[model samples]
Target chain A: MNFPSKLIEDAVTEISRLPGIGKKTAVRLALHLLKQNEVVTEALALAITRMREEIKYCQTCHNISDDLTCSICKSHRRDRSIICVVEDIRDVLAIENTNQYQGLYHVLGGVISPIQGIGPEELKIESLITRVNKGEVSEIILALSATMEGDTTSFYLSRRLKDSGIKVSSIARGIPVGGELEFTDEVTLGRSILTRINYG
Target chain B: MNFPSKLIEDAVTEISRLPGIGKKTAVRLALHLLKQNEVVTEALALAITRMREEIKYCQTCHNISDDLTCSICKSHRRDRSIICVVEDIRDVLAIENTNQYQGLYHVLGGVISPIQGIGPEELKIESLITRVNKGEVSEIILALSATMEGDTTSFYLSRRLKDSGIKVSSIARGIPVGGELEFTDEVTLGRSILTRINYG
Candidate 1:
């Protein structure tokens, strides 16, 4: 589209570079910023640039943090003996929001997806094994997704840790809390039945 | 949702403030940016901030521009005698893309909407009238939307320009080029029939 100003065109092009945002949405967003207070755009630009420039990855867990080590790994309240493994930092945030898990987390950065050209070596699997070899951890929980890649990564990790003497476990698979039995998929329903626990 | 880093949280907050973006999408976008090269984020931030800080509105047409007068208003190739009035700069781009309209544009910024607390005084109506009184323009095309607010604005402008001796017209409304008659709304269908022209 022909833009009246080069500045607007450049802004729209940059905005549409973001995932899931197309040119139409980009134009709309640029126009919205134009109509808003200059301070809003200034603050947004400052926040994004500062985040990209100053943010660091935790040297231990590989999770995004302001410092060298993330708060979770540094906290004494967290159980250092048990570590939960997940695909990325978002999963860490999700598990943290639940307030149920009190253990330290190891963010794998991504799963082993051959289709996407992501192998086990590309992830932080080596660092995780190094953490486990420190011998302080007693339990390793595989909290990856239910996808094929997640299962493959969990299986790979289990085999690698088989020699270490640490107990390996996985999060349970079942229908969601509010899900109806009739609406549940066949594979999930079957797994839910197979893994049924005794009522208290 | 809980964020691993405070910088990520701030960035997400600013991104989600944009129109049509929610917290979840904001998180996804922030993560995507984090995964990309730092140069991408820097360029995006710089483009947005520079656009906001340096862009100017056309003094003659009120359209967003880099100079005091817009390229369209300054161009000699465009038919200066005919002015097409639009609600915003996007409409000017749309019309220009069609390669059908060659007249100059007068962007009103927005239409009159009492519900939105937008009145004619808030728009560039006075400047438009001043341009019309310059005795150069012979016709004014009301190229606003089909909404009630658009119609109200067009009616208001036509009444204001009644004594100026300029011929005022509106864009033709009917079924879209690829629209099916069976799926057409009754109001538009009835109006199309009422305004039917002789067959070519």
Candidate 2:
């Protein structure tokens, strides 16, 4: 479609480049921005650019932080000996939201996906191994997803860290809290049965 | 949700202020931007701010434009004698996309709606009358939607322009092409029957 202004078209093109946003939504969003107060656009632009330009990953866990070490790693309340390995910062946020896990996080940045040409070398796997070898950790909880890539990363981590003398464990495979038995995937259901605990 | 970094949280807060985005989606978008190259963020920021700060609207039609007079109004190929009245720039785009209408447009900006405290004075109604009085040689097409506000605005315009001696006509109402007989709204169906034209 022919836009009346080049700026509108350029704004739409830039916005549509974002993940999950399409050309039509981009147009709508750009027009919406136009109708809004100028300060709103300014705030959005400033926030995004500031975050992208100044944001840094934690030196210890690779999670997003303003400083070299993340807040989680610095917090005295968190269990430094137990590191819950995760794929990225989103997962860190998700696990933190649970409020059940008191352990610190180890963000891999991403999983090993050969299809996307991403391997262990591309991720923070070497740093993770170093963190393990430095040896203050008692247990490592593999909190990655159950996807093929997640599983591959988990397997690789387990093998490399086997001789480190630290106990490594995967998160439990079980039906979700409110999920129906029939709706549960076969692998999770079957594994839940094999690892079933005595009724309390 | 508690974000690990202040920058992340601030970015999410700003982004979620958008019309349809939520806090969760905002966080996701923020993280996605963080993972991407710095240039992407810079470009997005520049585009949005530039569009907001520099964009201009046409003096004649009030449609968004890069100049004082929009391309549509300045086009020599378009019919200068006829002007189509529309609610906003989007309507101009929709009509232009049809490629059937060759006339220029007069954007009312919005229709009359007392419920929202918007009236003829709140809109560009006076300018439209002024344009008509300035010797528009022929027809003025009321291309507003068929809602109450649209009708109210159309009625007001017709009464206001009646003394100018220019022909004022609304767009025709009929069953939409490829629409099923059983699923049509009663008002539209009744109007279609009352305004039926001969079929081949």
- Candidate maximizing DockQ: 2
lDDT tens digits, residue span B14-129, model 1: 99999999998998999888888889999999899999899998998888889999888888899999999999988988898999998999999899999999999999999999
**What shift in Å separates residue A131 of candidate 2 from its native position after superposition?**
1.5
User: Residue by residue across A30-88, what tens digits does model 1's lDDT show?
Assistant: 98998889999999998998888899999999999999998888888889999999998
> What is model 2's interface RMSD?
0.8
lDDT of 2 by residue, B1-200 (tens): 97889998999999898878998889889989998999999999999999999999999989999999999988999999999999988888888888899988999989999999998899998888788778854899999999999999999999988888889999998778999988999999999999888888
User: Which ranges in model 2 have alpha carbons more than 4 Å from their true place?
Assistant: none
> Which interface RMSD values do the candidates have, in the order shown?
1.0, 0.8
Model 2 pairs in collision: none
- What CA RMSD would you report for each candidate? 1.9, 1.5
Error of model 1, residue B103, in angstroms: 0.8
| Worst 10 contiguous positions by lDDT, candidate 2 chain B | B128-137
